[model samples]
Target: MSLGDDNGYGNDSGRTDDAYSTIGGTRQTRTRLPDGEGGDGYNTPRRPARASRSLITMAGVVVLLIAAIAFANMGGGDGNGNDGDGSGKGGSKPEAASTAATGTKPVTGKNGTIPSGFAHDEQGAQSAASNYAVALGSAGMFSTDTRRSIVQTTHDPAVVESLVAALTKAYSPSFLKNVGLNEDGTTPSGLTFVSRTIPVGTKVTEKTGDTATVEVWCTGLVGMAGPGSTKPVSATWFTISEKLKWVGDDWRIESSSQKEGPTPVNGDNRASTADEIAGAVEGYGGFTYAR
Candidate 1:
């Protein structure tokens, strides 16, 4: 759920000067005794050996210095960068994409109850994670039919069956009863079972052409809403991490996990009555998320 060598100086006059090479901040001084002296050179010096032995040492040091600087530059990168030409990694990458709205329209289609037609890009991955979190956290996950639909619609085909089985086992009769639902996962005659996720924000923590890891920070409603309901609807805060594969032109979750949140302190507002909560839920429609 959450979370690894030379520097040289050369003097003129064809004299092999005693060479000092700094590699990785460690300086090495070598005494070159003409061609008879033994030393490791990174490259063959243009000048003849006896005269250019120190130059060779310098060349080796220069090569190492460049390599060290290059390695240093490549070290601290976020590993999500690309050269504009797409030929290398960790070039002068553009500024990180902001989490604020990008003005792009949200997806306009649905894969059954789930949103479809997400873009084949990072934004699309974020959207998929957000919407999938909502579907997975919703009341549909408690019902067998809708649960299967939610799992199949959002999960990668390779794992859909397994997820379905696991979720079915997890939402057993006792679990349902504990949550005030009927053994069959139905709402009681006078009660409305509320379970819905609202994504506060979505982030693409990792991304590639065909795979992505997105984290969706969410707040959800979970409980029963009706008069005399002991399980009154309450708000929950958490984050959902979704590993998505670009499967068949759309993002499907390969795996998913949840963790308790960066939740805020409880507010002082009075709790709404069960009837009011149910009415508000029915009156409010969910949304299709986007970057």
Candidate 2:
């Protein structure tokens, strides 16, 4: 699986200065009153009082506007604003650890490169599903023998026979050819067939003593890599939902299906050349993913 406005201030400042000027002008007018005029003769006009009140109201409004802007900038963390962290739920929950290292030990036992002997707990179930996703999405699936081994090893024993037959039919010679593989699922001469699934994370959707459903977010690279290759390797992100059963003392897939992605926005990184991609695929090994 592949895993995946501005503010104008110039006129406003002038208006603010005008307000201050009005208050200053009112004070200057008051100072100009006759020195010994009658007590009621120099009464300040209601206009100045109204202007003061209006100024207070405008200041209050400005304060409120500033507070609103600051609150918005702070995001309030109320689960409504998009923080763009890819949780897509705003700030409601801490971002799901899509690609963070879990620090959990990977499975030690393997059934021919497909992890086996999972612990039969929620973690184990998730681990099993993720690793199974990698196995099923690997270039091995294009071949007969490796595909059979993967199916038999990762699938529940009760359904292995049916799954093998079905998967075999699904990966027909025509399909292999379309993917730039030979009739026997081998890559053509001087070309490297790349089909690798890197799980970003796993979530247990449902779990019980003997059964569990897990979603593995994954990014996959598939196609042939070589000069002048028609099918250059490309990446795709998808989520694989696996229904697993505690069979034969370990988690095994009962059924699994894939959906297109919780894909992240593309970055501006330069795409690597075909040879570079092929070499990377060949050099770097995959991980045994856990929750």
Candidate 3:
């Protein structure tokens, strides 16, 4: 179900509190209209053998359609997996920059005396942007104090206040209630709330000295991953483009925008039980992302 500001997937500047549930899986089954009346206790007219042939033909058509869908899914949507691969543009420079470069590394220097240094070059900037995106889109952003700290620390000083205000309004009381969370961002009893963005890859779409715009095409794991949980965590893919500026010796996000991904189909992995999933979340702590 989508909730709480498109789950922070966009920058449209409005609180869109909407939620939806997928009954079974991501895809919904088509419901067929039931027969109104059974052919009363009498034998219905025997249809011609040709009618049976038509039914068989119809079934064959459906089978072909299903096969096509499966084949397409097997290829996956080519969503950006740690790079611009999902963009359907092959040999793109940004996608290949990291691997193609022989001897280049991010220039790390103290920015505003903050702990983590910013990447100095375009390549470094792209890497930094990708990792930063992961942290911002993480589940930790849901907790009240943590969320505030994250916004303040991760965002550019020039934009932090505005972003915070917008995020504050977006994650309002009503919004939290709809997502099954309290006004203070606490999870309901016996349920764990989860949200995290996993960066598949980074690409420097456009760059210049000390300032560049990089797009981190990412596949994120979100939702509550646990047992007896009404809202089990799920995944979503999107591209977050960030404009970065070298400030006090570091790259910082000045402004940003998000777009829906070239999402792919679900793989054939076995679905774990709720208890097992919950245990995994508790047992595992996410990483401090870097490109």
Instruction: For each candidate, give its TM-score against the true structure.
Output: 0.67, 0.65, 0.65
C-alpha lDDT of all candidate models, in order: 0.49, 0.46, 0.41
lDDT tens digits by residue: candidate 2, 1-291: 010001111111111111111111011001001112222211221111111111111000000100000000110012112222222222333356644655778778978786788877867887887676666656565567875776677766765564455445534577456546787778889878665566666666666679876656565555456665555554445455566778878887664443344668766566666677778878988676666
Model 2: how far is 225 from its true place, Å? 0.6
Whole-structure CA lDDT of model 1: 0.49
Candidate 1 stretches greater than 4 Å from native: 1-97
Which of the two, 1 or 3, has more lDDT?
A: 1
* RMSD from true fold, candidate 3: 15.2
Select the stronger candidate by TM-score from 1 and 2: 1
